[model samples]
Target chain A: MDRVAVIGASMTKFGQRESWVMDLLAEAGEACLDDAGVAPDEVEHLYVSNMASGEFEGQTGIMNALAHDLDAMPAYSQRVDQTSSSGGAGIYAAWQSVASGASEMTLLVGGEKMTHQTTGEATDVIASITHPVEYKHGVTLPSFAGLTARHYLERYDAPRESLAKVAVKNHRNGLDNPHAQFRKEVDVETVMESPIVADPLRLYDFCPITDGSAALMFCPESVAEQYTDDYAVVTGVAGATDTQVVHEREDPTVMGGVVDSGEQAFEMAGLEPEDVDVAELHDMFTILEFLQMEGLGFAEPGRAWERVEAGETEMDGELPINTSGGLKSKGHPLGASGVAQGYEIYAQLVGEAGDRQVDADVGLACNVGGFGNCVITTIMEAAE
Target chain B: MDRVAVIGASMTKFGQRESWVMDLLAEAGEACLDDAGVAPDEVEHLYVSNMASGEFEGQTGIMNALAHDLDAMPAYSQRVDQTSSSGGAGIYAAWQSVASGASEMTLLVGGEKMTHQTTGEATDVIASITHPVEYKHGVTLPSFAGLTARHYLERYDAPRESLAKVAVKNHRNGLDNPHAQFRKEVDVETVMESPIVADPLRLYDFCPITDGSAALMFCPESVAEQYTDDYAVVTGVAGATDTQVVHEREDPTVMGGVVDSGEQAFEMAGLEPEDVDVAELHDMFTILEFLQMEGLGFAEPGRAWERVEAGETEMDGELPINTSGGLKSKGHPLGASGVAQGYEIYAQLVGEAGDRQVDADVGLACNVGGFGNCVITTIMEAAE
Candidate 1:
């Protein structure tokens, strides 16, 4: 079977942006096309991964608007929505399009515009993805995070200071990523002392509401050879869903979706956790990083906090994670977060991450949606 | 290359229902799973085609809820949205999942809960798909239909009665469908005398806002053979998009998306328009039937009205269209409408349509989104 290759990638600054979703999508799409030296007319499939352009901006069918803006008229277009994992789902969709012979050149743009709405309104939209029975009573994602963090600390006897370290490390990484939202570094003291929104978690423990976009260009490996050799091949990609009702989980610490998707992706790549040299895990909340790390098999249950405290996931350490700062400081723009994760791995694989560069041959990205209601895991490698 | 085969299909009654979107989707999904004689655990991929559950019912993450409701745990799930063509887009996505070897079995459910909202609210949600520039000025889909109907009649010299005949014909066909929203036959006189909605068009000319769901089960030909002997193979499936700005179209009479997607699908099927034995056209409005017929190559430019007048499109005619009453008398549930179109064609090909079945070797369904801003055409054939 032929491999799907990502020949180009681009992303806008992951912070407050004045442009609407369509413009954000078009900006990244055009940059990706230019990066690959491919004409707009060559794109056979155009997919936009957007969660709630309708609810947020009163705009639907932005996929058509994007194709029109990019002069990719007559190209097949659709919107892939998997909540915050939309970008990872877009990658899987693009790979399917190329691998299935349905499209020769596929362009995937994932974006969202949310800063314009007040924080309360924006969080309300984000909260809507939770199970209605839970969300209707004001159980937002932050509440879930706080509850889960408290449980994890009690169950595993992990220190709260370890959670604060995640923020500090990611912020340090973000200082080097020009496109990140927060470019300034913070200390453990700062994150630990931040205003407490939820007990045991503070303002600095969560990703901020952001507006941005990201894109990737995909084609068959043979076709990608014509574009450039500095490309990354997505060796494995898979997604999975767990119970929608979060309370039903036998163990909240064990995200079933993450475990399943990660195992599937690694098996497809013919690799294991030990084989991955670099990684990017969803850090929507500081505690999520620990959960995903444990869920994806980087560490044993109740031991991920130990790894974080050991400096193993740092830039110069073994199996560096979130070299693009993850969502902690890089920003989480719902739909764009997962795509940006892919961009980080793609850049690391292609040796284009000048300042944030880390030695990497195999890379993985784990994107969690709606507190692990769904998750997608993708593994990429350098195309030789 | 192995073919992707649809082994089972089902749909709920297309009418006002008290169930929410999740219930409607699960109703169709469970029925489809049972029809295929497959256990929920066997479904590796589950897709939901929903346009605006959040905007309509303040519900999101429907795909996850559906997976949980159907007991299809750990299966990868995603939501596909292409406005009104969401179901067709879901079909394409499911096919890709199977053909790409991403899944051994895939289930797709397309649905929307709209009757709960007032017509003004429902239409407002639907109109969000149109370009903001036009919709901001109080221009909605019906306004476009009226203006286009007037232009089509004046430009092609087609009679207004020909449009009325569409409503008459579909209503007559709906009389035979047990699950149709409207089962009573109507005469051309009744349609002509209906209250004027958009100038030349009348109230009867538009499909009612409905609440319903439809589903299909797909797998590889090898896998499908183990499940069922009677099945339909999707020979060709393609989608395309035109300008988002409706006025920018070179000619309002020519639906570029319809023509392109139809041609692409036919070519992929190694067939032509003339080879199609039956079809289900998107008749969101009466005039759309004429435009689609002409766009799909059933008639020459400006001659679809003549074919309708000649009775060639009736159930007993040379190439029967809308045997499931299309979206006219059968009801249009936004996302479900396209899936229902596929269901009609699949039923006819598999000898299961009962009263509305036609002698079909090959069938096609054309789904239009946002006034032809995007379209999907799917061609299917009986699996021997």
Candidate 2:
């Protein structure tokens, strides 16, 4: 089978922006095509990863509108939504489009416009993904994160400070990322002292509701050389689902979607955790970084916190993670977060990540949707 | 390359149903698996084609929720949306999943629940796909249909009776579809006398706001026989987009999306319009049927009305179109309409269309989204 290659990628500022979702999408899309030096008409397929344009902007069919805006008329376009993991799903969809000979060049753009609404309204829209059986009982996403964090700490004998450190570490990394929403560094003490949004989990523990967009241009590996010398090959990509009713999980700390998707991705790539030089894990919540770390086999179960405490995941450490600050400090614009993760990984693999560049030949990105309801894990390597 | 095959298909009663969107999706999904005798665990990928569960039901993550409901745990799942053409996009996604070797067995479910809301409320939700600039000018879809119908009639020198006959013919075809929403046949006299909706068009020219679901199961041809002896092979599938702004086209009478997508699909299939034994065209509005027929090259430009008037598209005529009532009488449940169109084509090719079955070895389905914004055309042949 032929491999899929990332010819180019683009990311907009991941923060409150004046643009509507369509404008943000077009911004990243235009930048990606320009970065790749590909004409809009060359794009054979276009996919937009957006969770809710109608709910957020009273707009639907943004994908079609985008094709029109980019002057890429007649290129097939559709929207791919997997809630917050939509960007990851877009990666897999674009990969399939190329691998299946459905399209020779595919453009994958993921975006969301949420900051315009009040925090409560944005949270409600995001909370709509929760199961009604659980949501009807007044369950919100943060509450689930808090309960899961509490369960993980008690069962594993980990300290709450470990979660706080995740925020501090990602924030420090964001200081070098110009596109991140929050570039200021924070210490563990400041994180611990933050106001409690959920018991034991503070305001700093959760990713902010953000508005942003990101784009990736994909094509078959065989023709990638004609486009650019700097490119990353998608060695492996997979997505999996878990039980929707979160309480039914036997192990609260274990995200089955992550583990299953990660394992599948690694098997497809013929690589293991040790082969991944750098990684980007969904850090929507500080604790989620730890869970994905363990789930993706970077560390043994319950030992991910130990790695975090040892600074093993920090820059210049044994294995760096979240070089783009992740959703923690980079901001989680729902759909864009996963695509942005891919952008960071692609940048690192292709030696385009400026100050954040590290010695890396391979990278991985794990995107989670709806409190681990579905997850897509992608493994990429610098094109030889 | 291994060809993709459809092993089984199912459709829920497409009418005003009491079930929620999730219930309707599960209904068709469960039946599709049962029909194919495939276990839920065997489905490697699950895709849900839905337009507005969030706006209509305040629900999200429906694709993940469906995987859990159908015990298709760990099966990769995502939502595919292209407004009303979502179901057709789902078919393409499912096909890509199998063709790209991403999944050995993929199941697609397309559904919507809209009848609970008043007609005005449902129309508002459906109108969200219209371009904002045009929508802001107090234009709804019906008005566009009216204007387009008037233009086509004047340009083609066709009688108003031609448009009314399309509705009467589809209503007759619906009488045989047990799962169709409308079974009562209507005559040209009654349709002509129906209350005027958009000047040249009347209430009968418009399909009702519907609630329904449909599903199709796809796998590589190598493994299709292991599941079912009766199957259909997807010879070709393609989608295309047109100007999002409806008025930008030089020829308002031509639906560029349908034309482009149809030409591409036929080229991919190595077939011509003459080879299509049956077809299911999007008839959201009566005039659309004429436009699609002409756009798809089934007739010369400005001549589809002539074909309809000649009874050439009847069940027993040269081309049997919309044997499953075509959306006009079967009901237009937005996302479900495209998938239902595929179901009808698959059934006809596999000789499982029951009373609505026609003598056919090849079939085609054309699905349009928004106001000719995006379109997908699929060609299927009976498996040998």
Candidate 3:
């Protein structure tokens, strides 16, 4: 396979925005193109990842909108929505196109605008993320996580406080992240006392619905050589899905896709968990962060919580995780989350992550779409 | 790249259905697995192509539902949606997974359930296939085709009777296509008298809204040897996108993606248009066939209609087109259209296309998503 590298990355502030989603995507795209130092025409192809523009803003064919908005006419564009991992899927798709020698340069942009809808309506729309059969039976995603949390507590004598530690850690990290949704620190007591969206999962444990977008530019290793020193090569990319209906799985705690995707990607990259310098696991809900850490081979079963509570995942600790605060604090804009994860890794690996930069050579990103149905794990290394 | 071959293929009848979309997918998958003589457990991964399940069935996590429906627990699955080319995209995704060593065998399924909504609602839903800004201003897929049709007539002086000729030829082809939606043949007068949905586009000139699914089980050539001998080798695959907004194009008659993707794929396969024995181009509207024929390098501008009218596109003619009735007669189930195209080629190349079988050595499938914003094209041959 031809070497694939991400040469440029950028994102709009991931919070409620007054600007339209189209404008935001264009801004991010422009930033990415500028950073990559490529002309608009040089972007031979495009992959736009936006989950619910039609529901969010009554807009459809979002790829064309982005293309028109950016005056990047004549470039081919396609919209991709794999739920939360849309951004990652877009990047992956672009990578394959270039790697296969179809196109040398491609642009991947992802964005979501939830602020257009009322919070309640947005919640209902987002609830569509769960399995229809299960969700219709009164199981929203929060409730699903709630069940997992309760089961974890029972199965392993897991401390309820450990969940709080995740929220607190992310919130503290968000304090230094200007682009984070909730840029303030929170205490364990504060998290514990927050309103309950689902039993055992407080409102604070859930990532906020956000309006944001992220953009990345990719090129073959040969083209990337024309740019600055190699800083981020997409060494591996793997996506997997499990049961959408939680009840169908014998053990809902077993996020099979997570582990399979991680293992596959790591094997392809010829690396182990210990070789990862930093990690950004999807933390749509606090429990998800814990589950994903285990899924990504960062910890053994039921040990992720202990690691978090032990400060091993802290910014200055042994293995910094979600230094940009993750989906929990960085904000979870459904379509943008996965791409944002890539953007974070790009920043960290390039030494461009201000205030929250991690001294890392290799970075990993894990983004999960609706439940565990779709999960994409990508490994990136500083360009050699 | 490692050779990729379709070990099994199946498609649900093209028409309205009472079963749920996931159920339809399972039905198709079962048929494919049974045909391949491989158990569900043998599938190393899954790539599902679904478009607008959220609007049609209010289901979001389609991949998960499909995995569970197949009773393939802990298997890797991911949903891929790229407008109308979703099925082709799914096939491409699966092809890449196996070719890149991500999996030994992958199941590619593309389906859509659009009849659940009222005609008006369905129109609104599918209108999303047009560019947002252009669509919002009353432009739709039919209208986009109407504009192209008008241009073709004005530029090439192609007789309107040629449109009727294509309809007649494909519907006649559909007579032998058991899975086709429209099996009845009509004369030029019948087509001329059909109701006009948009200027220059009559009802008979358009494909119907369909609810169906297509499934293909593919494996890398190495593992495919373990399956069967009568497989369809995916010799070439390429995808490209054009201007998202149709009106932004320099020439409405020119399909940039078709030209680029076809050229790329042909180059990769070391073949030319002349080498293609049969062609299945996306013909959502009558004139689209003409535009795509030229863009695909099968004929020069304004000459495809002459080719069609002269019987050059007949099953036994120089270059047969849409022997499975295409989107026009096989029905346009949005996501399933692309894969269904591939299914036809599989049948033809395997010498299973009963009455309409073209004794061809090589075949091609072209799929377009949302007014030519994204396009996927592939070349296939009898498995070695």
Candidate 4:
């Protein structure tokens, strides 16, 4: 099988923008093509990762619209939706398009337009992904995060201050990310004093409602030289699903989808978690950061909080994580968050991440959808 | 590249059903697994083709729910949405999963539950795919179909009755399909006399809104024998998009997507249209059948109407089309319509289409999304 290489990547400013989803997608897509020095005519396939353009904007067929917008006429296009992990799913689809020899050049753009709707409407649209029974009880994703955070804190006897550190670290990282939604740094005291939205999870502990888009260009490794000398090959990519009803899980702290997908990705890449020099884990909520760290085998089952407390996941730590501010400070634009994570890892691996650059040859990204109902893990290595 | 083979296929009764989208999907999925004698646990990738579960039922995360419902936990699942052609898109995704060596066995289930909603509501949701500019002028898919039909009839000097014959022939075929929505036959006079819907085209010229689901199982041809000796190999599959705004088309009757996708599919299959012994063409509107026939190279550019008038597309004709009834009679359940088209072609190729059996070794299915905004063409052959 042929390996897939990332030849280009781009992301729009991860904040509320004036452009609609289609415009945002085109912005990122055009920039990505420019970055890779590839013409729109050369793109064989175009995949859009978006969760709810229909519900959010009363618009559908955005993929076709995007194809027209990008002037990539007659190129095959499809919308990939896996809730919030849609971007990660798009990565897998792009890889398959190249690996299967169906496409020589595949372009993936993921975006979401949310700020136009009220917070209540946005939350309702997102809550639709939860189990009907759970949703009927008003159990949105933030509520799930709160419940899990309480459980972890009590079960592991972890200090609440550790959770606050996640927000602080991501915010600090955001200060260096020109595209982040929130660039101002916050301290542990500020996060701890913030009003609680979900019990034990303060407002600062959760990602904001954001609108943005991100894109990547993928092609077979054999043709990477035609694009650029510096590129990152996707060594491994895998996705998995867990029980949709979150409460059905035996352990609330562990995300089965994350564990399964992460293991598959690592095994496929022939690398372990410790070999990952840089990482990007979905930090939709502070508690999620800890859970993913443990689920991805970066920390023991319940000892991830200790690593955070010790600054082990800091930008200069042994395994720097979320160097792009992640969904926490970078903003969680449903579909675009996962692609932005990949963009960060690719930038880091290719040594193009200006001020936020991390020393890394191998990088990993984990994207979780619907409180870990589904997760995708991707491992990339700097081309040797 | 490994050849993709279809080992199993199933479709629920295409009509107004009490089942939710999830239940309908599970019905087809379980039946397909049973048909192949494969356990759910053995399924590695599950793709759901759905255009608007959220808009129709306010339900999201349907792919995850379906994975859990089918007890296919840990299987990778994603939703493929390309408006009405989502099922065909799902086929492309499933093919990539196997052809790319990402999954050993992939199950694709396409479904839509829209009968519960009012026709106006359903049409509005479907219309969302059209360009906002055109949609603002009240240009829905059916409207586009009417305009295209008017132009084709005038330009080709074709009789309006030729369009009526499409409904007549497909209705006659539906009589032999136990699961078809409308089993009763309708004559050309009945169709011609039906109430006008969008001018030249009448109510009968359009397919009915329906609730149903269909499933297909795909794996490598080398391993298909382990599951079934009567499997069919997907020799060719491809998709393409056209201008999202219908008015931007070079020719209203051309259907660029169909032409592009069909050309690609035939090239990949290493076969010409003459090799197709049986076929199913999207007949969301009577005129669409005519356009696809010509677009797929089955007939000369403007002579498809003449072929339909000559009975060359009947069940016992030279190239039997829609042996299981095209969407015109089988019921257009949005996403399921395309997969059902594949099911018909597969059954015919495998010689398992009982009463409607056609002596066919090769078959083709063409699925069109929106008003020719995007299209997928697939060609399959019975394994010797």
Candidate 5:
């Protein structure tokens, strides 16, 4: 199999956007195309990830709209939606297509327009990310997160203060990320005092539903070599699923997909956990960060919270995770979260992540699509 | 690279359903496992496709729910969505994963539950498949199809009844399709007289918003070798994206991704258009059949309607298309439509299509996701 590389990547400042989804996608996509120094016409294929355009903006078939908006005539585009992990899946799909010699250059774009709908409407839109049976029984994402958080507390004997540490770390990191939505730093007290949406999962424990977009330019290793002397080589990519309905999982903490994806990705990259210098784990909910840290093999089982509370996941710590603020502080524009994770990793590995720069040669991104149903973990190295 | 083959496949009868999405997914998945003669324990990876649960059923993270339901602890599952073509893309993703040596045995499943919502509610749910900008302008699937149908009629100077011919052919073929949603015969007059949802596109011309599912089990040829003497070998798999917004295309009839997929699939298969004995084209709308025929290079530009009127694509005809009634008569449950298309081709290639079986050594399936945004086509042949 041929190696697929991320030659160029970009993201619009992740935040509440008054612009249309197409505009956000275009800005991000154009940034990627121009950054790669590739002419727009050189792009052979496009993938767009938008989770709930119809409810948020009453729009659909967004790929075509973006193409027309971007003047990418005759170029192909597809929209990928696996909720929050859509961006990661888009990259995975594009990588596979490029690896197979299907296209010379592929653009993976993800964004959402959440502000178009009122807060109540947007909340309802986000609620769709839950299991219908479980959701109909009044289970919101917060409620689900609460269950997971409760389980983690039960399993690991971790204090709620550990969860507060995650928010403090990511928010502090966000202060330096121009593309992050929430740049304001907060202390553990702020997180602990925030309104509780569900037991144990406070407002600060959840990522805000902000509108944003991120884009990545993918090419075969050969094409990538021509595109740039320095790039993020996708050494490994893997995606796995557990179940759509949360209740069906025998062990919610198992997060089988994340574990599987991480193992497979590490195998493909020919690297071990110790090789990763930086990490971007999906933190849609504060508890998700703890779960991912453990499931992704970065921390010992039930040990992520302990490590997090000790600032082991902070910028100066070993295995620094989510230096870009993560979904918790960077904003969770569902489809864009996963892709945004990639954008941050690429920046960090390329030494372009100015303030939050970690001395990193290898970076990994773990994003879960709609809970743990679809989880993808990709490992990238500084271009050889 | 490892070769991927279909070891098992099954689907729920397409139509309105009282069952929940999990129930439907479980039923279809269980049946697929049984058909493949493999236990759920034998599967290593899972991919589930569903377009909308939040709006239609207020569900999210369906994979997590289903994983618990299946009692396949430690096995991984992931959710994927690419509009109506989700199922096809899901299968393609699984195949690529297996080929890339990620997993030996993978299960791909897709389903939807729209009957739970009212027709108006369902319309809003289905309309999510359109471009967000266009959708806000009150655009719908039928409206989009109407525009395409008009363009086809004016561009090709084909009779309006030519549109009817597509439904007539598929419905006639559906009569022999036990799993078809509409298996009754209808004449051109009856189709022409059907109530118009959008001008020039009638109710009969549209695929119903369905609650159904289809599943396929994929394994490397090495592993599948032990399963059965005869199986459907995935000779070629290709996916490409087109403009998601309909109005953005320079020529709406010309699908870049569909054409690209066709080219790549044919090249990978070491075959040409003429080598296909039968095909299952994406006919989400009547005009889509004509466009896909042209896109697949099965017919000259603007001549698919003429070919259809000549009965060249009928069962036992020169090129049988949609012997499983395509999406028109076969219920289309967004994500399931693509996988269902793959299942049909698998059945046809293995000579298990029952009464609708065509004498063919090779079969093809073309599934389009959300208008023309993403398209995945696969060419298959029976194992020797």
Candidate 6:
């Protein structure tokens, strides 16, 4: 079987943008093609990872519209949606397209437009993914995070301040990300003093509802040389589901989907957590970072908070995490969040991350969706 | 490369059912697994082909919910949407899953629940896929079909009654399909005298707004024999996209996507149209049947009407088309329509179609999205 390579990547400014979802997708798609030095006509398949264009913009068929906008006529196009992990699913879909010889070149673009709607409206739309029984109880995603954060702090003998440290570290990293939604750095005092949204988790502890898009170009590894020398090969990629009802899981602090997907990915890549030099983990909420860290085997169960307190996950730390600011500071545009993680990893591998550059050869990204109802993990290596 | 096989198929009754979208999907999914005699735990991937669960039912993350409903926990789940051709795309995705060695067993369920909403509301949601320029002018899919029918009739010197005959023939075939939404046969006069919807096209010329679901189980050919001795192998499958703007095509009467996708599929199968003993065409509109016949090379350009007039596409004719009634009479549940087409083809290949049985070895199915904005074609053959 042939391996898939990421030859190019691009991301739109992750902020409250004026463009609609279609425009944002096209911008990232065109830029990604330009970055890869491939013409639009060369694309054989185009995939869009979007959770809801119809619900957000009253628009459907955005995938077909994007194919038209990119002038990639005749290329097969489809939409891949796994709620918030849609972007990660898009990467997996692109890899399958190449691995199955379905396409010689594939373009994956993921974006969401949500700033136009009120915060309440956006939350309601996102909350639709939760089980109706849970939703009827007025338990949205943030509430789940809050309850989990409170439990983790007490069970692990960790201080509430540890949660705040995650936001501070990601915000500091955002200062180096030009496309980040929040570039200004913040301290633990600032996060601790932030307004409360969901009890134990404050306002700064949650990622903002923003509008943005990200794109990547994929092809068979054998064709990577024809595109560019600066490319990354996807050594491992897998997705898994846990339970739709969040309460059904055996352990609330541990996401089964994350553990299953991560294990499968590592096994495919033939590498352990120690072999990864850089990483991007979905930080939709500060507590999620800790959960994913422990779930991905980066830290022992209930000990991830100690690693955060020790600055072991900073950009200069032994295992730098979220160098692109993650959903914490980069803003969570739903579908775009996961793809943006790929953008950051690809940039780091190609030595184009500018000030956020770290010593990295193998990088990993884990994207979570709907309180860990589903998750996708990807491992990429700098082309040999 | 290992060929993908269809080991099981199941579909719910096509009509206004009491179940919600999730319930409908689970019904077919469970039945499909039972048909294949495969355990839920054996499924490595689960894909749902749905155009609008969020828009229609205010529900999202159906893929995860389904995994939970069917006891298929931990199976990777994702939603595949290519407008109305989503079911066809699901087949392609399932095929890729097995061919790429990413999944040992895959289950795909395509469904929609739209009858709960008013016809106007359903039309509006479905119209969201058209170009704003065309949509603003009140151009829906039926309107496009009407316009194309008018042009086709004038350009080819064909009678308007020829379009009505398509509905008549499909309705007659539907009499044998126990699960079809409409089983009573209709004559050409009944169709021709129906209320006008869009000029030359009448109510009978269009498919209904249905609520239903369909499913199929897929695996590599090597393992298909272990599950079922009577299985159908996907000899070839491919998808293609045309201009999002319907009027932008060079020929108003010809569908570029249908032509491209069908050509690719037939080439991959190493067969020609004449070699196909049975077929299912997406007759979402009566005119669409004529267009697909020409587009798929079953008849010469502008001469498909002659084939319909001569009864060449009937069950006992040279080429049996829509033996399971096609979308025109089987009902169009948006996503479910395409998978139903596959269900029909599989039954015929395995000689389990009962009253609708036909002498067939090779079968073909063409699914079109929007006004030919995208199309997918699959060629299936009886396992040796």
Give the per-residue lDDT of model 3 (tens digit) for A1-384.
568889999988988899887888888899888988888878776778877776677666677567666666546566777777787777777776677555688889989988767888887777787876676788777888899999987897889999999989988988888888888889999999999888898988899889898888888887888887855899988877777666776776778779888998898899999999999988888899888999888999988988998999999988999999989888988888888999999999989999999889999999888777778899999986
Clash pairs, model 2 backbone:
none
- lDDT (Cα, tens digit) per residue for candidate 1, span B1-384: 899999999999999998999989999999999899989999999999989998998888888889999999899999999999999999999999999999999999999999988999888888998889999898899988999999999998989999988888899899888779999888888888989999989999999999999999999999989988899999999999999999999898899999999999999999989999999999999989989999999999889999999999999999998999878899999889889998899899999999888899999999999999999999999997
CA lDDT, candidate 3, residue B29 = 85
Candidate 4 wrong stretches, greater than 4 Å: none
lDDT, residue B288, candidate 6? 92
Q: Tell me how far the alpha carbon of residue B164 in candidate 6 is from the true structure, in angstroms, after superposition.
A: 0.8
Which lDDT tens digits does candidate 1 get at residues A1-384?
A: 889999999999989998999889999999989988889999999989989999999899999999999999999999999999999999999999999999999999999999999999998898998998898788999999999999999999999999998998899999999999999888989988899988899999999999999999999999999989899999999999999999999998989999999999999999999999899999999999999899989999999999999999999989798999889899999999889999999999999998999988899999998989899999999988
Which parts of model 2 are misplaced by more than 4 Å?
Answer: none
Residue-level lDDT of model 6, residues A1-384, one tens digit each, is 668999999999999999999999999999999999999999999999999999998899988999999999899999999999999999999999999999999999999999999999999999999999999999999999999999999999999999999999999999999999999999999999999988899999999999999999999988988878889999999999999999988889999999999999999999999999999999999999999999999999999999999999999998999999889899989888889999999999999999999989999999999999999999999998
Give model 2's DockQ, 2 decimals. 0.93
lDDT of 3 at B312: 96
Predicted complexes: DockQ each: 0.90, 0.93, 0.47, 0.93, 0.37, 0.89
* Pairs of residues clashing in candidate 4: none
Off by over 4 Å in 5: A73-76, A116-121, A132-139, A143-162, A192-203, A242-258, A301-306, A369-374, B72-76, B116-120, B128-139, B143-163, B192-206, B241-258, B369-373
Per-residue lDDT tens digits for candidate 5, residues A1-384, read 567888888999888787988789899988888888878778777788777765566556566567656666446566666677778878787776677555778888899878667877787766676755566788766788898899889888989999989989999999999988988999999999989888888889988878899998899878888868878889998877666667867787778788888998899889999899999988888888878888878788888888887778899999888999988889988888888899999998888899999999999999887667778898989986
Interface RMSD of every candidate? 0.6, 0.5, 2.7, 0.5, 3.6, 0.5
lDDT of 3 by residue, B136-255 (tens): 699888888888888888889989889888888888898888898888988889999999887787988998889999989888777778877788899888877677667768888888
Prediction 6 TM-score vs. true: 1.00
Across residues A1-384, which tens digit of lDDT does each residue of candidate 4 receive?
668999999999988888899989999999999999999999999999999999999999999999999999799999999999999999999999999999999999999999999999999999999999999998999999999999999999999999999999999998999999999999999999999999999999999999999999999988888878999999999999999999999999999999999999999999999999999999999999999999999999999999999999999998888999989899999989889999999999999999999899999999999999999999999999
**TM values, all candidates:** 0.99, 0.99, 0.95, 0.99, 0.90, 1.00
In candidate 6, stretches whose alpha carbon ends up further than 4 angstroms from where it belongs are none
